[model samples]
Target chain A: MSKVSDFFAEFVRRNGATISVYLFTAVIFWIAVLIVLPQLYMLDFSFRFNLPPSKIGTEEDVHTLKNYKYLLFGAEGNPNAFNWLHLEVFFRTIWAAVLVTILNLVICYPVAYYMTQVISGGKARIFILCLILPFWINEILRAFAFRILFGLNGPINFALVHLGIVPEPVEFIKADIALYTGLAYAYMLLMIFPLYNAIESLDHNQIDAARDLGSPWWRIHWRVVIPHAKPGIASGCTMVFMLTAGALAAPQILGGPSSLWFTQVIYQWFYTGGNWPQGAAYAFVLLTACIVFVLTMMRIFRVSLGEIAK
Target chain B: MSADVELDHLTIRFGNFVALQDANLRIPAGSFFSFLGPSGCGKTTILRAISGFLDPSEGHVRIGGEDMAGIPPNNRPTALIFQNLALFPLMKVWENIAFGLEVRRVPKAQRRERAQELLELIALPNQGEKLVSELSGGQRQRVAIARALAVEPEVLLLDEPLSALDLKLRQHMRTELRAIQQRVGITFIYITHDQGEALIMSDQIAVMSQGVIQQIGSGPEIYENPKTPFVASFVGENNAFTGRVASADANHAAVETHFGALRGRNSAGLKTGDQAILFVRPEILQLGAGTQGNALKSKVLAKEFEGFASHIHLANSQGERHISFSTSQEEALNISPGEEATVHFSPDRAIALPLGELAHE
Candidate 1:
């Protein structure tokens, strides 16, 4: 009790009472009004059915599970029929997110290792600047840029054709390759920075010691480097997975005609279908899946939440 | 099994900086040899070259009569104990010890048994289940030795492993390391800037200065017969006299200085009129002038009473030259500061060498 008061007293002394009050009020307002209130409202809204404006606030407007039921099964009268289309989109979004997370990890690990251990000084700074330069453009603009690059008449296709490696321009967008590529590129920096921060703290002597002990290059990483970088790997994987699954702009801009992402379904529900409650329920389900994925990853990697936060 | 290591005119360069100049040395099999020098004198570079972590820019390194030019560290017949030990904090102590065997696909049970045996040898038996962080500094030092020995290499390389310990533990580990080397009976190449550690633990010492080996001999030989001014000053405390050779003989030279003409052994072959410096050990300087050899008349500047002996600081009549010598505590107590005195030493106890770079504290 006194310790808590002492900490607050010290904080007040450092910032002055007026500034401390302002800072505390701002944090409270941000958390309660901007974040908690909307999530609470959405939770309540998700449990109730949408009604006519006149029917709202009347006996017809009552809390129910119809929104959730509609997700598992189609329309009211057909109880036996399953909504495989929405379910399939949900599973496919999860699968694609996992693939994107793995792709980002595989692409970022070696680059992170090289940046932290191999190169240094101005060379490292320039290498990192090149990585961050692409992200200076807005994500939506980059998605559009990717769309153009992967197009039939773009430079990629032109090179392939000129090189005589393909019979014709491959349908990258229609094949859904552009969507994955855009998502992977969009979140690559997130994975790389965490991995670099983790690996940079490792002692170079440990690597030399392992080699001196007759360990080959691969075994040295398996036993020493990767284990030391576990927390960073977990943090990067969690960020990439959650962001890829919740992503909307890249998927919509680069997805094929036949492809459907779960977020697209929720967007259609709230706008085209005029059903905000159903969209809220589906959003909560996606959030639940993300939470489970993070927990499972933490378990597999044997890392604590605090360690990952570092 | 043991193997001799030979560095044949090895040289290492980083850009324009020559870290280790053209150097040649042959370490005998099953001998404890040490490279002693100040920091950045290329001692660690030589250790790295022998361990296969570094390739000499010129010449070659041969171990056990085989050229080790292209072989990687993993395939070399050597193990290196890093300065920081570099024990894996993520693994148990036993796992760190048995890692080399594990890489060779040894069975789990056999590896564990071998780790246990090594732990016993290091006098830390049954402590293998703990983490490396749990061990004390001395225990960690022993653990590092065990880890290197677990690979059963023909040679072991140590790079100032005791530099991080406290003075007392550092002294204790010097004996422990020497005992371990004798027990293992392998060619151990140790690198250190601490002369005490090198003299106490090494059977043969190679004193280096500025990437050059100045002298290679036993501790007594290096202390008594340094070939260069740097070696004479670097290995121990000495009072130097700067002068020009007045006269020379086959075994002795007379140098004229501000004090007077001083005669000493002509180890560096100084001819007449050549610039030379005479070095005399402080312990050999007697308080009163003797009937033989060189003598200096000086005034006592200060007297520091150490437990075993007292140091007497003195200066010449003009006060241009300051000299120091140690005497018994009773004798130091009798001598008052600011009093005139004459110190004496035998000719064999001093040596006249061509003047070169002298070490500064």
Candidate 2:
């Protein structure tokens, strides 16, 4: 406790009282008003029953677990009738998020290695600019661009047909390929930056030493590069997984008629169905699952939260 | 078993710049060879070429009398110890040593046992489980050597691995490395800029300058009989006098200098009227006029007592040429600064050679 006070005292001494007070108050305001209050209100609202307009201030308005139970047994119908549709969407969202994270990792690791290790100086600068230039456009615009690019009559299909690789244009959107591709592309920068930061600090001599000692390239990456980049991998995986799971834009813009995302369900409950409490309940469930997934990944990778934070 | 390495007239070029040029060398099996030079002297380029990290633009590299062209570094039967050691920080000491064996699909038990044996070889017994960061600088250096040896390559290349240690430890490791090389009996190719290290640790030393091998010989031979002005000045200290060869012979020459004509052995065989420089080692120059050989009179500028010996700095009467020589402590007791002195040296101890680039202190 004294250490905490000492830290604040040192901060105040360094920044002066007025600046310290202003900074501390700004942080408090951000936590309490912007973040904590909204989450707490949603949490409280998720537990209460959605009462009718006439039940305002009446005894009928009470806290209940109906919104939570509704996720499992829909509409309070026959007891055995399960809400497998919502459950499946929930699991599918999680599985898709995991797949997207893995896909992004597989694509980003080699690029990050190439950037940090192979090409250097002015070439490295230009490569970074090329990577970040696409992100300068808005995310929605990029998603729509992906949708068009993956369309049946898109340039990709035109190339495939001209090349005689396929007789007919591939239905990429209907096959759910466009959605996965869009999600993977959307969060790719998040994965690459962490991996780049990690791999950039590695000494090039270690690779040479491994090669000199007769290690094959694959074993070199497995035993040296991958182990060294574990923390960055964990950080990237957690960020990509959470953002992909809660992602709404790419799924809505690029998803086909049959594809369903859990976020779309929450959006429907809140605005279309006019049920804020149920929407909050579903959102909270998604957040919990995302947290659980991150923890499980951390356990598997054997990385600490502190290391990821670094 | 060790194998001989031969660089058959190799040259390496980067773009238009020549990093190494038409170098030919033969390193005997189980011998410790060193390439000694200042930075950017192409010593490392030669080492890399032999280790298969680089390919010579011309000629070939042969190991055990077989060409090594097109072979990748991993396929080459050579291991390199980097200057920084480059031990894997994430793995235990044993795991780092066993990494190459693991790549060969060796069983886990045998790998661990081999790692233990290597740890003992480096005198780091029971330190197999500690991370690279846990060891000191010298310990990490030993670990790097042990790791390279664990692969059992025909040859081992070291790129100044002891350059990072303190002076005392560097001297200690020099003897330690020589001992290790003898025990293992592998062809060791060592690269360094320190002449002392090259002289102390190598069975043969190649002195290089500006991507060219200036001279190659045993340490004592190179020190006593340097063929070039660069080698004479670089391998050790020498006071040089610039002059024109007034008289010449097969084995001796008389050079006309500002201090009158001084005679010395003509190692480079300069004819009359040719420019030459006479080099005399400080240890051989004695104070006072001598009855034999060559002598020069100069005014003493300063005298520095260096415990066992005293160094007297002097210049000609015109003060245009500076010369320094060391004397015994008792002999120096009679000398003081600003005194006129005569330094003498036998012609046998001094040599005249064609003028070339001299080493800067």
What CA RMSD would you report for each candidate? 1.7, 1.7
Clashing pairs in 1: none
Error of 2 at B134 (Å): 0.6
lDDT of 1 by residue, A1-310 (tens): 9999999999999999899999999999999999999999999889988876788899888999988888789786765688787888999999999999999999999999999888987998999999999899999999999999999898889999989999899999998889999999999999999999999999999999999898988999899999999999999999999999999999999999999989999899899989898899999989999899789879877899999998
Calculate DockQ per candidate and list them: 0.88, 0.87
How much lDDT does each candidate structure score? Answer: 0.91, 0.91
lDDT of 1 by residue, B1-361 (tens): 9999998999999889898998888999999999998898999999999999898999899999999998999999999999999999999999999999999999999999999999999999979999999999999999999999999989999999999999999999999999999998999999998888988888899988888888898888888898889888888888888899999998999889767888889977899999999988899899887998478787788888889999998885358436889999888877988888788888877899998988765
Q: How does residue A256 of candidate 1 score in lDDT?
A: 96
Which portions of model 2 miss their true places by more than 4 Å? A52-58, A78-81, B316-322
TM-score of 2: 0.97
Give, for candidate 2 chain A, the lowest lDDT window spanning 10 residues.
A73-82
Question: Tens-digit lDDT track for model 2 on A117-176?
Answer: 898889988998999999999999999999889999998899999999999999999988
TM-score of chain B of 1: 0.97
Q: Given candidate 2, what's the lDDT at residue B251?
A: 87
